[model samples]
Target: MIRLDTIKDIIVFLLAYIPPLLVFAKFWREKHKNIIVLIIITLIYLGGSIFTQNLLPFILIIFDIKFIKSAGTSYLDNKIDNTYNKTKFGRDINSVLKFDYNRFKFNGRNFSIFSALKLSAISYTVSLLISIVETILLSRLNVKLEGQEVVSWMSSMQLWRFIIIIPVMIIFAPVVEEFVFRWLFFEKIFKNRMGIYLSALISSLIFGFAHFNLRSFPILVWIGIFNCYLIDKKGYWYSVFNHFTFNFITTMALLIDKI
Candidate 1:
């Protein structure tokens, strides 16, 4: 049996259980209505999984974007001059981050190749720092890193798991996560005329909360805020490229350690 040996462990345990408790409370308060609602959702999901052969998620995403709602590039005008704007790296990166939309329309130019390279190098360096922090924290905790079991599975002869997880981490994660957190979420928060940093902080807190990793909360918030600012200024692809590079480096590191 696992023991909450320290105050940190107890706190972590409580934080982990809070979400589930709140969810249960919601249903518990109105069991009749909530249970029926839950059953309907479950039935629809079951039907979709059966009929669509697990393509329901894709179908839902398409429906959400096309019919339900889609995130726009809002709050781009709220950016103001700052100390970071005066920095060399910031100026250079922002220059490349600019997309020539008219050029894309006329000459088919999309994004600067140099920006992609810059994002890759920057992400690699940042990921290294994050990995170091993660190592120190994980060492102190009894709990495993999120998805740590995947490392052991990969080390074994789990070729099918390899086929599934590798692409999901490197490809799907970058696109989906960046869209949800940076694009969709940031727009939601910045709908009011407020300080950009406050909006970023709220969203970053939620991002960290969503991960269910108490130990990694600060790291996640830093990533969330950084990506928020990045996506705000640098645009979607730039942020996605950074996230992609970050995940790719992490996946590669885990693979090397396991194998």
Candidate 2:
């Protein structure tokens, strides 16, 4: 069993969950541009996922730009400073995070790049191992006297399981999340070395919180940060494949759990 005491577990939960939730709630009510929203979401996410929280992870999981009703005015102060400036480029550049597909360049020369594959495999493997450790640790925690109801709620989702969610997780989530979090969010805010680390940390936290399960938050953050690194280093497709691999592995684990 995971030998953590009740107090220690609570401390971990609070550290990981509070910051991101504060950030998310801070900006959720405001009106901002897509770029701004993207930046704040990433920041808030980082804050929230630092500590594992039971209810907060679910909120983090489904929280994407599309699901957000509209952009609020809670503009990212730094991102806006960099993006909207008086230059020859009179209008904002939408091409940076091109939503349309034709703009996606599939350079034939880089078709069999080993670095990309290696990065994806290594990161995915690391996340899988981390998640396994977290699950085992969580299973050992003395079930919180007050958390049984919450666990029951989560258990209900197990009925449908991986078979129903793998496609959505691997394909749809990677496309949408990478576009919003990395292409849009990281591009604007993460300009310098400090910004890069901050962006990766925040993006990972948000990714972790989105999962809503305390036991899984650590793994999600690990995966999220790794994906952030891939995106920062190799661009969009790298992050996508890394994300797909992590989810695929998780889906397999979930399936195995059924047996």
* Candidate 1: residue 85 Cα off by (Å): 38
Predicted structure 1, TM vs. truth: 0.53
Give per-residue CA lDDT, model 1, range 27-73, as digits (tens). 33322346665566545754554443224333333333322111112
Candidate 2: tens digits of C-alpha lDDT, residues 152-235: 443345647535555665665565556545644555445354577887788667656544566667766877787677666565
Error (Å) of candidate 1 at residue 96 is 28
- Root-mean-square deviation per candidate: 13.1, 10.9
> TM-score for every candidate vs. truth?
0.53, 0.50
lDDT of 1: 0.52
Q: Which ten contiguous residues of candidate 1 have the minimum total lDDT?
A: 67-76
> What is model 1's C-alpha RMSD?
13.1
What local distance difference test score does each model get?
A: 0.52, 0.52
